[model samples]
Target: MSLGDERESSGGYGGTGQTRTRLPDTDPDSYGTQRRGPRSSSRGLVTVVGVVVLLIAAIAFANRGDGDPADDPTTNKPEAAATAPTGKQPVDAKAAGIPTGYAHDRQGAQSAATNYGIALGSADMYDLEKRHAIVNTVYAPDVATAQLPDFDQAYSGESFLEKLGLDKNGAAPSGQTFVSRVIPVGTKVTSYSDSDATVALWYTSLFGLSGESSRNPVTESWYTTTYRLKWVGGDWKVVDFTQKEGPVPVGRDQRASTAEDMTKAVEEYGGFTYAR
Candidate 1:
């Protein structure tokens, strides 16, 4: 039998009618002594109908205001169109291991910026050859050629590598795993044209080493990066970019994960090519 049936069969309040009670009427004159007059009952019915009519009128008035709640400046409700998805399919091609073939529009520009942010912040960017490939794939030809040396210098410094617990070759120490990943939270197009666009990407990143003996355990940081993109060779390519510290939210009260779990997660879970 089901648990409910078993309970019913156990002779408790579920099956028995003994728990019911009939309270005494509030009107002493109508409690097993006298009946209410027809006039009094009719009056109560009229009162109830009047109250219902008032409630309906109030509701109608509330609904007939100047505009929708979303349009009202004082309301906290956001416009539906702001958050609605555009329903555009994600790009299905990659060039130099980065997503490519974005549409020539605002949404496409945002998509390009988002994916470029992820590529630039990834651990692969630490490797010189992979870094060069990313620079060429994501930047306009002239910009890439101009900035390649600067990028190389910035990422190749031994001091920078040592700070992140990596060796001169940007490889983690033996038995340790290095992690650098950018997860785009949102994207916005600040300005757009047929050939050029400016977009901003707000993102969080996981960086540092994950291992038992590592001094720099992987941690999260938030930032916003703005990209100036130009349509070059039929794709959105970065011409220039800048980054700043986050519009960070307050951290939650949660215990940190063990280094082993972090390392395992980084190894097991693959990242995504973000699009808007």
Candidate 2:
């Protein structure tokens, strides 16, 4: 059965109220020590060091009186807002080419959900081996094992592949590039614990084929996916998730990129390792 058929038959894992859509045809050096010199040279160096120290001390005192710019309401510096960077670093490891090794906190759960959502929506999901690897890496062990066969059946349908202008193997036709990308606009932690957390990722996705001969030109969709994550083996892994179509915004009046340009853009640009 195809993904749509599976969704219709059983609602699928984490299907919730999500509407299933048809597939479009589619990352610093040190210095060495020096030898001591003459007394005058040593004294000069000491004087210079002392002067520098004093200058630093003076600057510190001046800044101390002013307090932190962030703390000072009168300061012109922008306040830390919800949209501001959280200073949290992204995961530094990869499992089956998907980012892993997330921190063990709410932010980590959110990050894991966001990245996993991207992986789930990626073009790689269309390929059996790649999809399996992604599922094993992103989902909890039991979930991965249980869902593997379902995923394979859902994504491997010959009709589904053909609808997207792909072969049974999910490869695009020659000279055509399939596009499937999810860009997380934001994430929120709705629930949290040491062992479990629930995160919602709001995102926009581009999917379809970017080629001159394609009938389903690349198009964008907005979605929000809620992921229930578990801390497993020192990393956040998906336990369950649900997707819902947009909280979509009004479409903007802009010229769409040509197929060649879209293909080039997808090829030239790289996806991000998202963080909170």
Candidate 3:
């Protein structure tokens, strides 16, 4: 829906009535980043498409944060079938230290699917070195070796960087810091088995193009990204993935923050291990 189509609607089964809001869908292409005279330009014309791309960047960066991905207790346990030897029950852990625990069976697969989704959509993918670290961390050893180079080529290409309005290595243009971040709102297990699973992640992504003369400026989007996961090398690793537009709600009518504030928030506030 277009941003101009935003409306408030409320009414439900419980009769308590719930109002649903939606973000305005601005044009993704027209805006160039040029703050007018130090005052933030209020061009409410960013597209819903841009938001999804930024979500990928956000998740990628957060995945590279401190601590070990393997050590996450939430997704690290063995399946109940393996533990029980009978292969009938499932295993699950909701431990605090874990990224987000899962049951040894389908639950574990679903959990893996969700966490992997976060990793895949993160910002670390922009940096070759960090991108390698993330691919290695999340994928099976063989898969990492074989797929890392491909991912490297795909994300590191000059054209790809330019498309996002970045330099050869994906650096933001002068005076502008790129903000591509994904915040997973929630996840759902669509299908699963003992060794595989498919999960749908509902998320909000932000992509910024904040400097003067920027070809690509900052924007936000909401969408659903799904990951098909497999149990590999004793952990859940992504095998395939895809993205789609959302059942996105309308955005707030609050005043937009300045470019500087947006930049600071991106730098200062880190992402989280999403749950529920």
Candidate 4:
């Protein structure tokens, strides 16, 4: 989400003036030197009164839902009706750095999808031990065991790391910054039930290397990753997930930062713990 990124003080106040003639305390048509007749003054007063009354009505209407959320739409709705979590709490516990033990509901399914997306696409995925931990913690137990061998080969194979400008050990070469990160834009619950739910997270992933000498430069790509969540052992776990290209928007013509700057930015920026 990082694209990569004053006050005026008044000198002096004018002194109060004392050169105007004071209007008479009582005069028939002398409210001011320009003079307004009583009838005109009354009309003016009525207009002012009307505006004040309207303002009061508007203020009251705006605050009508302030007292009780259950009694009003503006106070209770939007947040409740929206796809965002509906009063359900995100997991307070973590399993091997991944959030787990989600509530067995629609909100929990969406939350699990978001956190799983991050874990699956994180830079840590490049490391064997951490990657295995993530898959185990986020995936259904049986599936994690099954995917382990292939998962290791996919990330640890010589050609795989070489293609991404990384060593066989998954470390970037000297003077290069490795970037593998996914930023979840939002989540959508396409389907839900007591036992199962399907959620999709639309996200942008940054991958490749930040080195002028490297062939693969860090870049962003958009995809929607759908997760089929199962309510396993009182928590939502990913049974399977898939990614498809875009819902991509047209690229904005912005200045491209130098590789050095991009490296610095990625190094300094920390990833977010997202909840939907």
The C-alpha TM-scores of every prediction are: 0.69, 0.74, 0.60, 0.67
**Residue 23 lDDT in candidate 2:** 35
Candidate achieving the largest lDDT? 2
Measured on C-alpha atoms, candidate 1 has an lDDT of: 0.70
Q: What's the CA error at residue 98 for candidate 4, in Å?
A: 1.6
Q: State the TM-score for model 3.
A: 0.60
For model 4, residues 1-276, the per-residue Cα lDDT tens digits are 111100001111011111111111212222112211233333332222334444443434655634666677556545535565445665689989788878777777888889888887777877888988988888788877876775675567676566566788789999888787788888999999998899989987776677777566666667787788888888888777655666876454344677788888898988776654
> On residues 11-62, what C-alpha lDDT tens digit does candidate 2 reach at each position?
4663333435433112001110111112343333222233444444332333
Compare candidates 2 and 3 on TM-score and give the better one: 2
Q: How close is candidate 4 to the true structure, as a TM-score?
A: 0.67
For model 3, the superposed segments whose C-alpha errors exceed 4 Å read 1-103
> Every model's Cα RMSD, please?
28.6, 19.6, 18.6, 26.1
Clashes of each: 0, 3, 33, 0
Q: Give the alpha carbon lDDT tens digit for every residue of 1-276 in model 3.
A: 101112223121111223232332323444422212233357554444334444443422334447787656545656655443432232243222235334456656655655655565566667787777766666556666766655665567676566566788878877878766777777788887768777887877776565544444556677786666777656566665555677677554445566667777788998765433
Clashes of 1: 0
Q: Candidate 4 — which residues are off by over 4 angstroms?
A: 1-89
Highest TM-score scorer: 2
Question: In candidate 1, what are the lDDT values of residues 1-276, reduced to their tens digit?
Answer: 001111222231111222121111112221111211223333332222334444443422334476677765546746456565764568999988899999888888998999888888888888999989999999888878877876676567776666666788889999989888888899888888999899989887776677777766666667787788999999999987755667777554345677778899999999887777
Model 3 poorest ten-residue lDDT run? 1-10
Evaluate residue 44 in candidate 1 and report its C-alpha lDDT on the 0 to 100 scale: 34
For model 1, state the Cα shift of residue 207 in Å.
0.7
